[model samples]
Target: MSNASPSVKTPLYAQIGQRIGQMIDAQVFRVGQRLPSLRDLASQNGVSVSTAVQAFHWLEERHLVEARPKAGYFVAPRSRRPALPAVSCPPRHSLALQRKSRTETIAVFQPQGQEVTFGAAYPVVSFGGACPKDPLFFDDDRVRVALARATRIHRHSLIEYSDSPGTQALREAVARRALHLGCQLLADDLIITSSCIHAVGLCLRAVTKPGDVVALESPTHFGFLDLLESLNLRVLEVPTHPKQGLSLPALQLALDTQPIKVVLSVPTLSNPLGAVMKHSDKRALVQMLASRQIPLIEDVVFNDLLAADERRKAAKAFDQDGGVMVCGSFSKTVAPGLRLGWVEAGRWKDSVSMLKRVQGGPTNVVLEQALADLLSQAGYEARMRRLGALMKDRLQEARGLINDSFPRGTRVSDPSAGYTLWVELPGQLDAMALFQRCVAEGITFGPGALFTATDRFRHCLRLSFAGAWTDVERRALARIGELARRQGDAP
Candidate 1:
């Protein structure tokens, strides 16, 4: 055999193209800004001038970057795409919409009109939305193998309806995973749904009726609040802490004062604030709810992304009276497109199952089988380890940037786990107004108002560093700081 190891086939033009592409994406060349001379680029990347020219030509062909005579190459302006249609939801009443007229007005909803999506608590990666960076990060190879096996075993099953309760294998796997979290469950205790949101909807339908009161965390998930409102349920906001999570004393007060029927919270790595409740507190909460017989809807989407030793203990772990209904999903961990989530309804299993059947019949059978296969392949743990490390590093970078770039008096809530950062801006700078400015600059973020029950966090905002590049995050922070300073200095 030759000592030359198969002459590692290197394509010089392709390498040049990739480098230029990255530079454009990094905003090294702004829209309508001229690129450096081909000779300079060749010298910089150590390629021939012709190769650099060829790369620019390829970019032009793809409409990614354009060449201007004497001005050189610049990033092409992206074509504006049509907006997505507004999601049709049934009319309902809640604090968010109750302020508006009671008349059935179909508000023209367009997600594009919203500025700085930091208001929404989705992970911000290149792909955008709440999708994870590596869909197969937790044993992609295994998922593929399992998908193949499932396909062979159940042909045309993809077109058929899934088991009303969900696949036995997947449910068993979920039960096993729940046991690890200190909840004793069997396969029958589970009801699979399309996603955590779906699971929440099912739980809500099972317990509360129209016009009934439900207690929610002060700075809770907006989707949950919206869902409750759509179902015509009255929402009572309970005080919650930024670090300790939902305040038990406040919760008790609310339960005592209001005729609340359901309590919804994310006990682990709570969205926006990223706080995890203590085990003792969880036990107390479980007991408190049990005493009132108030149904608890636990959203644990971020449960699996915990740091190795600090895995949060769930409220379901302490449910001796079976009032806690735990909802979790693989969307945040495995593949969001799969839309696989389950609810462990201790005593409400039957109700939840019936709700699932009524809602949309059943979940996708093929996808569930694929996820089950993915979990069983023994690669899930290693994948999580790598993902956890990446998330930690990214979050640290984000925190450092915020601290260094933000103006004085700005406070940041440091999360022990998860990829979100909740920041309180200085002075009377409104987050919503700041978001509009950010949108004008082609940057997006979550406003703090959406996270709070009252509009008290008007100066705060939430950011996701999960999918953003380090340089992009730095620029965004700097821009935000400048805007904040300007707002503060104004009369």
Candidate 2:
């Protein structure tokens, strides 16, 4: 895999460009397919625009891709084809849920109050990774200006506790934004919460009580598992496809067989697998929930990150009987430090609002106003576009690395949007063992066991490509592959 020659070293940009060629040869990208924007390619590969330009030129010279005027590069015609990963098949049973024991915890956490320094867990090019704000995408100055302006302009509202369901201005902003997701909303239906997870928790509390059976995707989000466990709920995990968000038929079967009370899901850009449910499937899921009279707590946090407009549509958009409760936050798509999330509970709006009132008071008016300003600003859409392109590039880069370094039998999910990747190694490879070894080498990753109630995905793991693809981080990923290979080779 070493591309460097004996006499001369290959440039990083050249290597990246060559990787793109390999992808084209392998038919991972098809003929006439548009390439990511030049800036996006640069950001994803951790190179400069000039470097990406050189890379593209190199591809052009080799006849792998051709540039179109005004449009981006596209893959040239080729004969070879590349195979995609297979869909996932989770076990068909409810699992005994347990909390994370101290010993089971991965040793990747730094001491509290320590200033977070990326790639600082080890010396000499460390790779201990955590989900941090990418400077390439987020503009810190813009956020600061918005916060300062809000504090100055809304100083009068700081003295008193606002409405229990959040400020009207912020709700109106959210309602306006929901239109893009194909959701029709009124500000009165929205209730702001501390965070997205908090919004989900509130929705769960509003509908179901302790000991109730809740259905969710197999290999679901770890945070949802923790929330369900904290609420003393049993889990009936429905099988999920890597490409499709959830298996509707399996969920229907579960509904018929199990005493399911509430079904929770992240339909658009689901975590770990990064699955974006098809639009038709979203509508079908909504109707199914309505037919059963079961409420669905749909997490649409990653909806805005989707590339296609139709893909960004919320499951609640198709809910005819108000059976879907949509929850979302600005942390993933917008400002992370704001700690703001909202829920639009259809029929159970009063119940969710009541639960919020009992659990906590109103959200900060100043922060709400600031987020409102940010969301309403014209620059917001442009920022989202840049972010989407950046993530697309990073995903392609990481996937290339995974294919190059991992074992031959390894498979990775190709999500339509978002920064998370679900990797399935060969059967014999234990993700927990790989996680421990990677941690020993000062690299951090999420093992698959953490995301499930059962031991179904012990051979799987999740990686977040949210950060910059610096040399250290890239090397760390390769190092993880090496460690996994060693583990796989063991007797």
Candidate 3:
């Protein structure tokens, strides 16, 4: 909410200066026009005169505004900057998916030192975890209380293994929560798993054997590709729009030609792309899947992060014949440490349950009960609100930086929700090389090649602004932009 960088290390004055810089770049103050007086500016920004003075001085140093004698600073005339990057232009034809060598990816091992990481898609340390960060998002005391209550009440079940289909209380809780996504789920139909991805894997395994083709958004979560690869399933990459989500016509083409056994998608707040399917489009997608008798594994892990209520509706909401299976986890929304996920397998509930039981069995009963308590509590919505606001602020800051600092031809995504940005660098810059360069500078970001089965996002990359956008992260973004510019300049 505040313009302050959230990082204690970044002084309030510096943030104020950055805010003013942004305004200037937008041409808020014309050249030769006197700027607001120091006192008024301070009052406007809720800062002290000293801070305002410091901000103006900082601007003057950059030659953006000049301080005249006795008069306040005036905006300096500057050449017009280039336009932002354009939307992606991937090849029209689908290609056979290939396995990537492990060395191609810069694996995100545990941080060793003060590395500025934008490489991994996970939330930053401040907002890190599958669940909302404790204290900042979810109340730690509340979680502990729920855990204690669950333990006290279900102490006898501690020694016994959990139900293969999961605890009844947790299933009921999940059913209640599904209403928000416009899904009317039965507790009996739900199956609990170790995590959301675990549920997705089960759905994949149940629906298709190895070598069967699966259709997915072209620029999907790298994790999805990893799962598909491990499953030994061939992938048919469908063309996904930056904002509208999977192209239905493109998908229809894939369905007509390829032997796609199932479709795995994150319809709401899709990973990397952050594309949200329109409600009508969602219905159409469900109908199309039903017509083809294909299954949909909808990942609603990031659905709660959408600002608009309409945008949070999952594709499963439109399912009438169990063609859509909803997969979710609390890692991104509630608490990551919980490691709990759920799946409503539609018609394949029995199969998914069997696979889950055979593969990994049930999750911890106490943890499931605790999560149920957390979900049933009133604070979950408020926590999501806080998380969404924080993510929006971080995203806006990052998008602005990318627009201003990145190479002239760099195209960036303006997703409706979530913290990830899909960047298409101009001049055919190799994202892997960019990743290596950033790593050398103690900075890391997700390269484009890692996200797909084919050569779709070779010049693209993904950046997550889910963490605190401190001076270090900001500098890292600028450094990436500089590197991108240099890469574009190279022969």
Candidate 4:
């Protein structure tokens, strides 16, 4: 078990912290519940009190527990005990994607991009960013060395065009990674694209023509909406739980009622909401789609960020008849600069491969080789753990601030892992109006209106904590809440 654990290379106290973490996750110890005294834990585990203290400290750093002056240790409340956002039930009818003006699209799309300044000389603090930016989350030196080694090794390949379906080494590397998601994919079936978004676009193109209907989670990733619009596809948004992911029953109903050609979802650590489907539910989702012959474009870009191996298993693992097209990239969890993403197209392999060649073509083989090297290296899981902990600390702290500073009745999500929080402000407080106010002050977050084609989420916003968290950033977050509070009862 130790050999398999990402925390194996960590200190012994940290390893013990893992055990306590499992307990916490399983609800053997409820949130805000007190744990045994340090002495009792030491006696139970046959270690000294000093070691137990260190173990508790390790958990504290990860925000799994808190130390009080005389209250001993208690399980830290997730998202500071805020009421979770209610399950979303978007309008049942499938509707064509609305095309926005380029200027409006740029205003919303700019936040999700990696660039710091969006052509504005004035500085803006973005809370809508999706990529992790802090250096503490990844080992930059390791990435540099890997890139250099791959460059030296594959120098001759630069003059060569990478194979249409990607290099064998990178494909094999992705197959190996699929194992972590409980998938035993064949490397031959994989096609490397520019990014996960690109892979999804290819999948959509391969399966459906323009004006085809697709069913996706409500308050879905805004990027998906943008892609659907570009493809001229219609969408039906299904009801989705904040923590459990897409509602299968709603999806089934949509399939029966609408001409849904595909289902696109982020089953594990879904963007913005960070929902991880239950294992049984994942299997059910695959089976449901397979029975209907409806293709599923499953996005697993954030799968590796989850801590538990069992929980990391993807819905694609349950695919039996090639109905699931699983897409992923390491840019979010590993190297953001690398424009590398892969997809196993299941039954639509040939179609997706052809689309890859016809569309943007293959990525740089040398960079792919570097990404392969990075993926196959040891301590990858440990790096993910580091990222998880860093995000955990910040998210908990942000939740606390939201609790104190946001409008009354404000609700936020409690994700298993990842860097974003879906905040539901008071219903009367228009989140788009709030976003405009924040932007005027040089601050920005994903307005709820941006996430959906409909207006259901007009009071919500997705706050991202992936970037550097300085005092200025903290104050900016607090300021957003202040504005929301002021506008809580406004018309």
Work out the TM-score per prediction: 0.74, 0.82, 0.81, 0.84
Clashes of each: 7, 0, 11, 0
| lDDT tens digits, residue span 1-491, model 1 | 12111112225765566566667768886777777789988898888888888878756744568877777787888533212111112112234335221121112121355543542322222311344553323334444666778888877886665547898888888877776577778787888888898899989999988988887775666677668768888887766666777778777777777778898888888877777788888989989999878889999888878745346568888888789999998877776667889998878888889878866658777777877866555545555655665566456556655655666677776667776777777777787777665655656666666654455677877777655454555666667777777777778
Candidate number with greatest lDDT:
4
lDDT order of candidates, top first: 4, 2, 3, 1
Cα RMSD for candidates in order: 12.2, 8.3, 6.0, 5.3
Query: Lowest lDDT 10-mer window, candidate 4?
Result: 1-10
lDDT of each: 0.69, 0.79, 0.77, 0.85
lDDT of 2 by residue, 1-491 (tens): 11211212345776788789778868789999998889999999988899999999867755678989999999986522213445556556565567673234554443346543444544333322223456665666666888999999999988876656998889999999998899999998999998899999999999988889888887788888888888988888888888886999898888888888899998888877888788899999889888879999999888888765666899898988788999998887767888899999989999999989988756888899889988887756656765676576567667767876787778888877687888889877988878766655567777888778877788888888776667677788888888888888889
| Per-residue lDDT of model 3, residues 14-87, tens digit only | 66776777788787877888889999999999988999999888677555788888887888766343343343
**Candidate achieving higher lDDT, 3 or 4:** 4
Regions of candidate 2 where Cα sits further than 4 Å from its true position: 1-53, 57-86, 101-104, 107-132
Q: Over all chains combined, what TM-score does candidate 4 have? A: 0.84
| Winner by TM-score | 4
Stretches of model 3 off by over 4 angstroms after superposition: 1-97, 101-104, 107-135
Which wins on TM-score, candidate 1 or candidate 2? 2
